[model samples]
Target: MARCPKQRKKAVIAAVSAYLELLFNFINLLLRYYEALESEQEQAVEHVSSWETPIARQLARNSFMRCIVSHGDISCTMLVRMNCRTFQKLCMLLRDEGGLRCSWNIEIDEMVAIFLYTIAHNEKNRQLQATFRRSGETICRVIKLVLRSVLKLHSILLRKPKPVLHNSDDPKWKHFKNCLGALDGTIVNVRATKENQERYRNRKGTIGMNVLGVVDQNMEFIYCLAGWEGSAHDGRVLRDALIRPNGLKVPRGYYYLCDAGYSNCEGFLSPFRGQRYHLKEWGGRRPRSPEEIFNMRHSTARNGVERAFGILKMRWAILRETTWFSTKMVTKIVNACYLLHNFIRGENGADVFERLYVDEDPDEETEDVDEDLILHIQPTVEWSDFRQNLAQELWAARSWITS
Candidate 1:
């Protein structure tokens, strides 16, 4: 059972060497793992730092500027809804009068373009953000800034009422020589909450606002009073307008042609109540009575307001579609369109107006959408005589023509 000393020594040395080798390998593995852990921690810190860094804004200014310059006329008229000269004029107004000097790298021209494009095309914030290469918040802010700027030009855009000189030479307007303009109301669709829906609902069960406007012979809006609920009667709205501090007014000798929705009173003239008055009533048929002749002339002169409304609705699509905006904002939009309509007409000539009216038959002339039941009014002796005299004059003029 006893082993030799030499053999026993050799076995002990072999076991000790094996244990040392194992210890060395374990220490090397620990070092490698620590290095890998340190590298991962460094990478995590780098990733966190990168998120805090801000990126420069990309405005796409050159691209947009080039597009506008390349197709300058189209961009100015169709896209921006104004001629180049007018656009520049507005830009100046926004800077000086509107107090909208560009800040934070937003140019005045860009702000105006954004506002016009948004309303003219009825584009959403997201669409504008994508198109202009800007953020949604930036696009929205710019639109508001330019909107307020454009609205500042209201006093300049809206015309002042002036008397038309009496003339007997032109048959078309000779009878209306003293007429200042034509007055009418239009309905624009809008979105309202359930609580306010009834107030905004029209007879057709659609939410809308009744806008009263007066247009001169030049088809320029002289006065506009919007924000009346669709349920509000046109006559009531007009009455309110007459009482406002800066509302519609007619000089002693001047009057505005109105439909039956308005009462026949001083400073306001209306056609015969129970007679053929609308333009369609005389198509391909001569007027049968003197009252008919007067109505025809009255309707012809009143077409100015109808044509103005048509032009306004055609130019701004935002008015046609129901928008998710507050009632106040919608009212402002309507006013802004009216103001701009006058501005465009003043800047451009009658040809531009005629072109926009092409192929579009005039809408049926009506003062109110819900004026079917005419309200009878007992006119004062003076007003009654005035209307009778006017009608008689129209009849006498017609007799002269026939003879």
Candidate 2:
């Protein structure tokens, strides 16, 4: 193996170079393996994420389905404020008539259920998101869509008033022939911008909108006007309603019974001022005067509107509280509530909300009419005489019954 010195040096250099080359190749292979492993991990993570989304969505949908189907009708009513049958019918109406279509992930029934649950319970967006297993944006969009759909049914939902006929045998309305309904204004809470808050501040010093509602003897709303500032007098609101082209319409002879807050105009009847009115004032006591007798009967007959408002507020919790929507949206919601109320009353023979009001008077307090405020439409002399004659006739009828 002995060799020359230069030859041996050359052989050692070649061996060292070969070793360095082999080391470089081995390092390249290790880098390629590491990159491949990292790519596989990323693909695996993407697959899991994509797979979990649909699974989670499916689970949420299944849970909602179980709540609707397996929980029974009581739970359904408790959740959405209506029986299952009514809920289904409402959904069908919205789809068939209202042009409501289902979203990719949510069904028509689920969309309606979301809206009903939100209004019935006044649930917040976050709560709705959690309950419906949707994002907050999705929840808000669904609410608006369903609200529009429900409002589209207003024409059918709002009842057409049938005046009390002359041959009416019902004691509550027999005394007042050709009476169309009862008209009153209620203050519904609303949240407005800082600049508009003062205008909405009512006499009670609360931010609200004065809602004018006209309901028939059956407690069905015939007309509704909402969005007037609370500080606006009821008389002022009524005046506006009268002037609007599509506003409250009164037949020539038919009249609506109103509290003294309204003027005793030609088509509106108001009880005598400076006299004891309201049923509570005459409870368990005989009417001492003809005026008192008239006021008692007037209050009893007009109680239908009050009870309708009570049942409406009780059924929909959103009406009882300040809504988070904009002023315009709140007005729409108020109208939608009225429409739903009429629909429920017309469809259901037995209403749970109405039952809760049996033998119970509404909590709304009556305020004295501002004579000066209502001077524009002064009490017509003819209508005043008619009221007096009616009062005298009622007094005589009471005496006859006693005798």
Give TM per candidate: 0.78, 0.82
Best by lDDT: 2
Off by over 4 Å in 2: 1-53, 360-376, 399-403
What clash pairs does model 1 have?
A: none
Task: Point out the worst 10-residue segment of candidate 1 by lDDT.
Answer: 362-371
Residue-wise C-alpha lDDT for candidate 1, range 161-210, written one tens digit per residue: 65555644544556876677789999998887789999999888889999
**Model 2 lDDT per residue over 102-146, tens place:** 977788998988888888988888667657767778898988999
Predicted structure 1, TM vs. truth: 0.78
Residue-level error in angstroms, candidate 2, position 303: 0.7
Residue 17 of model 1, lDDT score: 90
lDDT of each: 0.76, 0.83
